[model samples]
Target: MNKNKKVIEVKNLKKYFNVGPGLTLKAVDDLNFYIYEGETLGLVGESGCGKSTTGRTMIRLYDATAGEVLFEGKDVHKMSRAEHKDFTRHAQMIFQDPYASLNPRMTVGDIIGEGIDIHRIMGGKERMERIYNLLETVGLNREHASRFPHEFSGGQRQRIGIARALAIEPKFIVCDEPISALDVSIQAQVVNLLIELQRDMKLTYLFIAHDLSMVKHISDRVAVMYLGTMVELASSTELYDKPLHPYTQALLSAIPIPDPNIERSRQRVLLEGDVPSPINPSAGCRFKGRCRYAKDVCHQQMPELREVGPDHFVACHIV
Candidate 1:
C-alpha cells in the first residue's frame, strides 16, 4: 500500500438528479473512495450503477450534489478559475465511445491539438509537432492525423482519443470504459497500451469497466457497486479470494472457469429479483431484493462501508 501517495481523495460523495418535480435520481449515493499516485483503481458494477457518474462528477463534469473531491490534498470543486484551468491540464478523461467523443468534422490532428490551442501551450508549428508525437505515442502515425474520425477503425479511433488526452500532459486520467466498443482482440491491445503509458509517464488512472476479468488484470484495487451504492472494495486478489458481501460473492460465482472439470464443479448463484431503480430507491439496502441472505435489518437500515479486514471494506448486514 502506498500510504504517502494519495493523489485523489473522495469523501462521502453524492450526485443526485431531479428526475421530475418531486422525484430524485441517486446516481452516486454517499460514495467514498481514493486513488493513489501512479496506481489504477478499478470501479466495476452492472449497468447504471453510477460508476461513470462518480468519475465524471469527481472531475466536475456534473456538479456534485454533496461531498468533497480532493485532488493533491486540495478541494477540486472549490478551485479558482485559474486553478481550475490548471486542473484541466493535469486531469483528463477518455470517453466510452471513441466515435461519439471525437468531432466528426475535425481532422484527427485538430482534435488532438484542441487542448493545446485552448490552453495556449504552443505555437502553430509546435502544436502540430506535439499532435504528431501524441499520435505516435498512441500507436498512430502522423499521416493518419490528417484524416477525419470516420476514416479509422474503432481501436484506431480510441487511439486518437488517447492521443487527445495525452496532448495536455495529464498526470491523471479517468478511463471510462475506453475499450468497451472495440473488438475482443483489440481490447488486450488497448489495455497493454495503457499499461505501457502508465509505466512510461507515471500516469494514474481510475479505470471504470463492467468486465471483471479485464478489471482484475489492470487494477491495483477493485470497488464493486450496486444500484448507486458501493458494496465491496479491496485489493484485486483479496476481493476475488474472499468476497464478503452477498452481491460480490454472487458476481464472482458467475465468472466462468476455463477448465471443464472446475467449471462443472463450481455452483452458479443466480439472484431471483431484478435490480431496483436508482430513482426513488427504497430507504434500505439497495441490493436487498437480490440478496439471498437479506433480512429485515437489511430492509430497514442501509449498510455503511466498514473495514472487514486489512484494506478490505464491505457494506452488508452479514459482513
Candidate 2:
C-alpha cells in the first residue's frame, strides 16, 4: 500500500456554507486523514455527512474554511497559478451522478480529451490515439467516441466519466460515490473497474460512498463519518470486525449479511435520536445525542480521534 508515501494529507479541514442570515452549515468539519500512495481510503457515512464535501475541499474544488490539504507535501489551497494547474493535472474527480457529470452536448471523445487539450499534453493523431486508447481502456470503443452521453447506459456513462478523469493521467482521484447512481448489479462492475485501474495506473483514491460493503471490497482502510465529524478510522477488516465508536458500531451493524441464520441471530444497534444539525453545533461529541453510552463528559467535550489499537482510531469517551 506504500504507507510510507502519503499521496494526500488532510489536517483539521473545515468547509462551511453560509446558508442564510446568521446561519452557517458546517458541511465538513475538523476532518483529519491521509491517503497512501497507490491505495484506496474509503469514506463511508450517511447522506449529508460531508463525505463529498471533504473530497471536494481536499481537491480544492471548494476552498477550505480552515486547515490545509497537503498533496504530496504541498498545501493545495496555497498553490500558485501554475502550481494549481499542475495540481489539476495530477488530481482528478469522478462525480457521483454520471447523468449529470458529463456534458450532454459533447461526444465521448471530446469529453475525454478535454483535459488533454486544456493541458496541451498532446494534439493531432497522438491526441486522438490517446482518446481511443482511453475509450478502449474503459471498455468502450473508438466508434462510441462520436456518440453523446445520452447514447450510453448508466454504467457506460460512468465508464466515460472514469476515462475523462484518467485522460489527465492523474496520480490521485476523488471518487465521490462514483457507483452510487448505478444499478446494484452494475455497481460492482464499476468498483471492480476502479480497482483494476488503480492497480494498473498506480493511482491513489479517496473513495466516498454510503455503501459499507462496497467500500470494504475496494478500500485498504475505511473512515466513518457522522454529522461532518469522523467517528472512527481503521483498516477495512479491523473496522468491520471490531468497531469501537458507538456510531461506527451502529453503522457496521446495519450492513446486512448474506446468511439468513446469521442475519436473524444478529442484533442491530438502533440509534434512538435523529442526527443533530451541523449549523453552529454544540461543543460536544456529535454522536453523543444518539449514543447509548453517552456520559456527562460526552455532552461537554468533543472527544478527539485517538489511536487505541494498531492503526485503529476512534472518537468516543467510552471507547
Candidate 3:
C-alpha cells in the first residue's frame, strides 16, 4: 500500500442533529481518519455508533455540523455546484438495506443508468448497452434489466445496488454495511464480489460494519468505534492480536473462535453498564463507564487518539 496516497482525509469531522427545541444528538463526534487509495479501510462499531452517519457525512449526503472532510485535499461541503456534481461522479455509496435503497418504481436498467444520465456520459443505444453490461458485470443477465427492484431477491437487489454504484465508474465508494440486510448464505458471495471488483477496478473503499470477524477478512486496516468515538485503530491482524484499548479487547473477545477447543477455553470479556448518550455528552473518557480499568484521570479528561506502537493508535489514558 502507498502510504502517501490519500483519497479521503477526515479531520475532526462531526455531525449533530437538532432533535427538539433544546435537545441535540451528537451522531458523529470529532472523527478523524483517512482512506488511502486502492485500500479497504474498515470502520467497525456497534449499532447507533455513527458508522452510517460518518459515511453519509463524508460523501456530503448530510452537512457536517463541524470540522472538514477533505476529498483529495478539496473541502467536500464547500464545493461549487459543478465541483459538487463532479465529486458525486467520483464518490458513490452502497447503502446497508438493499430492499429500501433501490427504487421500486424504476426498472433495474434505469436505476443503473441514473448516474450515467445525470453525468451525460452516453445516450441512445450506448446508454442501453452500458446498462446491459453493468447487469452482466454484477452477475445478472440482460433480461433482468427490464425488471423492477420489487421483483428481485434481497441478494439480487444488493447486486443491483453494486451495479448502480459502479455505473459512473467511481474511484471511491462508501460501503455502509452493504451485506447486513442480506441472507447469511449470500453475504459471502457479495463480499467476494466486492473484493474481486476492488482488485479489478483499483477502487478505494470505506467499508463500515459491526461484524469484527468479517472486517478482519476484508480490511487492510480496522478502526474500532464506541458510542461516537474511535477507541482503537491498527492493521486488522495486529488489532485482533494486540488491542490496546479496553473497548477493543472486549469487542474482539466477543467474536467466537472457529476452533471448538480454543473457543471453550478462551475467556470472554463482557462489558458492563449501558452505553452513555451522545447528546451533550459529559467531558471524560467515553469507555470509562464500562471499562474495568478506569482511573480518576479517565473520568476527568477525554483522551485524544495517540500513537502507541507503529501505526496502532489507542484513546485510553490507562493504556
Candidate 4:
C-alpha cells in the first residue's frame, strides 16, 4: 500500500446510543483517521473502549450519530440504496467470535456462498466451485463445506469466517478482533493467514484488537484509543518504540518482554483508577483521571490530534 494514498477516511466520526430516558452513551466520540489502500491500520485499545463500535460504524453496520466516512472519496453514510449495496460488496468484516458469527443452521458451503447468491455473482456449479475454492483458500477442504459450523473446531470455524469474508471478493475488510477468541497456538496461524491473504488480495484492512503484540506484527500503522477518543496514531515501529501519549506509553509498557533481564529492569507505567465513563467524559484529556502528569488545562479543554512528527499524530496537551 502507498502510505500517501488513503482508501478510507473517517472524519469527526461519532456514534452514540440512547440507553434510557434522557441518557446517552457515547461509544465513539469524534474520531478522525484514515486508512491507506492495501495497508493494515490497527485500532488498539482496552476492551469497551469503542474499538468494535468504530469498526461496525465505519462499515455502516451501525449508523453514525455524526461525521462522515469516505470510501474512495465518497461518503459511506450518504450513499444511495444502489451505492450502499455496492459499498457492501466492496467491503466485508471478520467478526471476533467465530462460533457466534457463523450460523449453526446453515451448512458451511451455504454460509460462505450467501453473499455470492445475494449478489447474484454466480449460481449452481459455478457458485459451488467458488465455495470449494474459498474453503481451500482458508485452509479447509471442499468436503468440509457440506458440514455445519458446530462440527468444526474453533480455529476451523474462524477459517470458515475468513472464507465467508473473502467470498464477496471485497477490497476492504474490517477485522474486528478476529483472532482474540482463538487459542494462543491458533492465534498466530489465523494472523499469518490474514497477512498472507492481504498480500495476495491487495486488501486494505482496519484491524481492531486489544492485543498489542499481534497488532504490531500485522499492522503498518497503529492508532491508540482511550475511552472513545484517539490519543495517538503512528507507524507501528514508531508507536511501539517511542509512544508519545501517556495512555499509549501505559499500554505499550504492559506488553511483556521476552528477555527476562530486560523484563525485570524495565519500569512499568502503572495507570491508577478505572477507565472513565463515556456517558459524560472529562473536558480535556480522556485519560486525565489516570494520567500521572495532569495539569489544570488538561481538565479545562479537550486536545485535538496534532502532527507531532512525520506520519505521527498525538492528541494530548503535554505530548
- Give the per-residue lDDT of model 1 (tens digit) for 95-199: 999789999999999999999998999977888888889998999889987999999999999989998998988989999999889999999999999999999
Local error of candidate 4 at 149, Å?
A: 0.3
Worst 10 residues of 1 by lDDT: 1-10
| Residue pairs with backbone atoms closer than 3 Å in model 1 (clashes) | none
Q: lDDT values of the candidates?
A: 0.92, 0.94, 0.92, 0.94
**Lowest-scoring 10 consecutive residues by lDDT in candidate 4?**
276-285
* True-structure RMSD for candidate 1: 1.2
Cα RMSD for candidate 4? 0.9
As for candidate 4, its clashing pairs are none
- lDDT, model 3, position 259: 97
- RMSD from true fold, candidate 2: 0.8
Candidate 4 ranges beyond 4 A from true positions = none
> Which residue ranges in model 2 land beyond 4 Å of their true spot?
none
State the lDDT at 32 in candidate 3: 91
lDDT for position 217 in model 1: 93
